[model samples]
Every structure is written in C-alpha cells, then in structure tokens.
Target: MRTRGFTRCGVIFGLSVVIVRLIGGSTGLVCYTAVESLDLGCLLRWDCLHASPNITYTVQTKTQGDPWQDVPWCVWISSRSCDVSHVFSDFELYNMIRLGVHLSPSSTVWIKPHKFDYSDFTFSPPSVSVSLKNDSISVKVQFPCATNRRCSHDACCPISKLIDPWTTVTVYNERNRSDNQSRTVWTQEVVSTVEFSGLSPGQNYCAVANFSFPTFSIAASPKSAPGCVETGSRWGMLPMYCVGLALSLLFLVLFLAGFLRKPRRDRTTADNPPKPLATVQDADSSAPPIFVDPCDIHVELVDDHSSIDSFHGFHKAPTSGAETKRSSQPTHFDHSRGVTVQHEVQDMTFESYN
Candidate 1:
C-alpha cells in the first residue's frame, strides 16, 4: 500500500509539471483605478519567453446574449501586456465586453464583463484636450479604439475578424455641468482629433471624450489616469479676459502718450494779421510761383470789362521793345444784383497764363 501511494504521488507531480510546460507560462489579471470612481481602462500582463518558437496567446470576447467570439485577426500575441503599444492597436477592444483567454484547449479562462457607468463624470472620467480657435472649441483626443485584435479565420487556424468601437465626444457649458450638453459627436474611425465650431466666445465650455476600453487580466486600471482639458477657440472666458487685457493696455498707452505731449497756444499776427489768400494753386507742376517785390504799387482798374482775366498774365509781344502785359485787379461780380467788388492791389507779377 505504501509503494502504490508513492507511485500515485509521483505520477500526479509529473503530470502537473507537464501541463505547466505545455502551457508555456502563467497569466494573471488585475484591474484598478486612480480615482475613487469606477476604473477607466485596464492592463493585461503575462510572461513572454523570447525564444525561437515564441509562445502565442489568443483572446476572445462576448457580450450578454452573444456567443463566445474570437477577437479579430490576432494570430499570435508576442507582447507581455495589452496596451497602446501592443497587439491591441491592430485589434480593437472595448469595455463591457467579456474577455476569454485561449492558449490551447487545455488552458482557457473567462473574465467577467467590465461594467462602467460613463454617464456620470464621477464614475468614468474622460481623456481629452480642448482649445479655443475662434468662438469654437478644438478638441484633440487619441481615443483608444476597440481592443487591437487580428482574429482571422484560417483553414489551419480559424479566428474571427470584426472590430467596431463607437467613440463619443461632448462639449458642454460648464455652468450647466453635465446637464446641458451643447454638442455631441460620434465616430468609429481611428482619427482622434475633432473641432466644434459656432461656440459663443467668452463663455465657459467643457469638452469630454469617452470611448469603450477592452480590459482583461488586470484587477485595477493602470496608473495612467484619464484627464479632461478645458479650453475654447475664441469665446471662452479665459481668452476673452486676455483680449480685454490687451485692449486696455493699448488704451492706457495711447492715453499716456497724449498726456506726455506738449500743447501749443493759438498764435495770430498782432501788428499785421496774415492776409487772406485769393487764387488757389492749380495742379500744374511746370508753373512756378512768381515772387513779388512787396514795395511795388500798381492797379489797372476797369469799370466795364468783358470778363475777369488772370492778373499780370503775359501775351506774345508784337514789338521787340514793348512787352505785351495784361494787368487787372482781383474782381468778383454778381450779375443778378449788378454789383462788382474789386480789391485794391499793391502789385502782381507772373510769366505765363496757360
């Protein structure tokens, strides 16, 4: 009886070691959170033997009523963890989906579905950055798509290939909190950046981005906590405050410059007030001003004249000795009233009339 019991113990220990060797390694799951609220994303980790014949891992997922389905196109997983840098980038995964680990028929484990209440900010926080462009909010968020999976159906090795993770973005008025949702955008594309225009400048806005996360293996969310970035294009209060500050500084500078400049008193000739100008200058650049000797006194006044003509305007001289000169006083006439006002002239001189 003692010999038989020893034989059975040795057999059992050998079988256990054989099973561990066939499985390649052990896998553990942990999920946690940085905030007291529900966790956001999770991390999956395992030991990897970097050998010629690398160990392969396959993951499966299932919803409430759905049957067990393999994650898409993922033939063999080489990484030790499921993260942004791992196979998940190729295979989209999300939260609320149950995960199944399949290495071989002998080693398989199922994880419970991760339930996250994202409607409440306290429970599920968003990872996003907001900026103000011009009365608009430009939000940039690299939202992780569904778990990166490559579960292709091979004749030799069959797997599933279907990844669709819906991403939702929301821009809300901070005053309204989560109650008043101003705008919401939804897409499945991997592009992580979007813009929200037609926003009221100088208002408070909050941008939040939320998407499903495929979590397994981890009992807690990773240390990289999701964050929210508050910003606007041009209407946010912060931008408006900056603009107003700039304008105020400009006004202050102008005021200071005006105050520092000296003021001059109005001046008028006391002995001889400056004489008023008569003829306005024309645009002719060739005609130069003719200087008058101020001492010369002359006036050729006519009572009945054909019309007012240019003063001291010259005509072609008929005789060599006699210069053809036309002289007349500055005169203005009112034909309706038959009144003519003539100014007494001291002297006037010019070269040409054209």
Candidate 2:
C-alpha cells in the first residue's frame, strides 16, 4: 500500500486560490456625482446586464481638432464591467475619467445645462471644444545601457544589459486629453550609451525601466530598475560569504578555548614525595685534629648494656663527647644469682649468658 501527501507546490496553490477568491470579488462599488475637468478624452460607459454576452459601448468626445482628435480606439467587454483599461480603472471617482474637458481653446467652452440623450441611455455634456495644441518639442535626457557592471553616480547601468541586451525604452507622453490615457506617445528604443536626444522637450514624460529579478511578478514587471544612485553592482553572494566566514571563525575560537588550555598537571603524591637530603657541613677548616689519651685509668665494662640504643638506624654518627658520657653511665642488671660479663671490641655481640 502507498500513502499520499500534499506537496509544497500544492499547498501554495491552494492558499493562492483561496486568497484570490476572498479579495477578487466585485462586491465593492460606490456611486458618486459626475463632473468634467481639464483632463478630457472620449468618455463611454455601459451597465453590463448580467444576461448580456458583451458590452456595447460608444465614444463621447470632450475635445476636437486637438493634437489627439477623438475617435473610437478600443472597446472592452467583460462579464461584470468593461474596465476602461487606460481610461477608467476599476476605481470609483466622482468623475472616474476626466479629460481636459473643461473647454477647448478655440471655442467658448461651457457645461451643457441639459442632459443629452443617447441611443440606449442619457449622458451629460455631450459636446465640448478641442482645447489642445500640436507642436514639436525637444529635451535632453541621460541614456545609459543597463550593463552587469557597477553603476557610477552620473552613469546609469545600461538598460540593455540590465534586463535584455535589446530591451527598448518606452516613454509615455499623454497630451491634453480627457482621460490620462490617449497620451501614450512613444516607446522608442535607446541604443546608445551617453545621452539620448530629440526627446519631447517641454512636456512631462513618464518613463519606466525594466530589469531582471528572481520573483515572477517582479521579472514580469516593466519597472524593474534598481536605483543607480546607491549601488553599482548587485551584492548577490558577498554577504552570505561574509556571514559564513564569521561563523567559522567563531566556532574555531570556541573550540580552542574549550579544549587546548593548559591543565594543572604539576602535582605530587605521598608515595613519591620530594625529600630534603641531609647536607654535609665542614666541621672547622681552621681547627687541627686533637688526639685524646687511649686509657684514662678507670676503664670498666658495664653488663646489661641495653641503654645504648643509638646503633639501630641513626643517620648521624655520634660525637666523641656523647660516647664518653654514655660509657660513664651506671648499668643495673636483674640477673643477680648468675650473671656473666664479656668484653670485645671487634665482634661485640650482646647476649644474656647464664
């Protein structure tokens, strides 16, 4: 028999699905008043009937004869509502899509008091003037290829090597129009290093760069440019290497401190203790040797001479004065009935002979 378990991928996929369902609902919507402003482009809206297969939409211009004249560009239809992709995002604004719709420069622009009627519905401010200009402008912009090298303060990592060697620079210039869209001017390719010239000089340009990242969304995003202000090259593996080196040094130090220190081995035991040997001192180098008389007339051999107990294991030899005194001491014997005394100098062995 075999058992099955969920893998990491399966768990991640399940969680992602749950999160999408929770946050990806269309129940969030709010209604508000509609007012037109300077940001004017062709406006169109439709309430998607739940049963309809697609949304039928139309264009209502707030400007004309402008650099960007109004004409039907694209039509999007979704089950819920067609998200006017550049025109109106899925956000609720009093006037979600405002083109420079106030009034055209050539005409006396005023808000139409009456709500104009449409085919299927009624809309307001059906007509307005084209208040815009068309002219060529130029500006100087620093252009650098995103290379794999370090970036300097003034130089940008060349965008080419940063994302793709052949990656192009896309610049979006939205002209005077209703919606912030209709302003996509150019997505030109930059193939040079120093600086790019002949850019739309005076107008505001919104530019984004692309680079490579490990994340899927980040890699797929067009704004992958890491700032050139701080770092020149990516510190990919240097930090990890430094951390590993530090840990290794720390472990080595700990091991040495724990095991390599000197132990207290200089000790002794009772069986083999150190002994101070007796020192041989010179008697008196200046004194001459004096010989005493052999017989002082009263020489007597004492019996039961157990009093001289100095011959057992004495390390020092007895002096002459000590021997004389020991010889003069009286001796008492308990063997009174029969006691015999014998004297010998060389082989003197003492024994009680009865």
Quantify all predictions' global Cα lDDT against the true fold.
Answer: 0.40, 0.28
lDDT for model 1 comes to: 0.40
lDDT of 1 by residue, 270-293 (tens): 545779755444434345644444
- For model 2, residues 312-351, the per-residue Cα lDDT tens digits are 3122443333322232333332233233333332322322
Superposition TM-score, candidate 1 onto the true structure: 0.27
Q: What does each candidate score in C-alpha RMSD?
A: 21.7, 26.9
Worst 10 residues of 2 by lDDT: 119-128
Model 1 error, position 335 (Å):
60
| Number of colliding residue pairs in model 2 | 30
Worst 10 residues of 1 by lDDT: 32-41
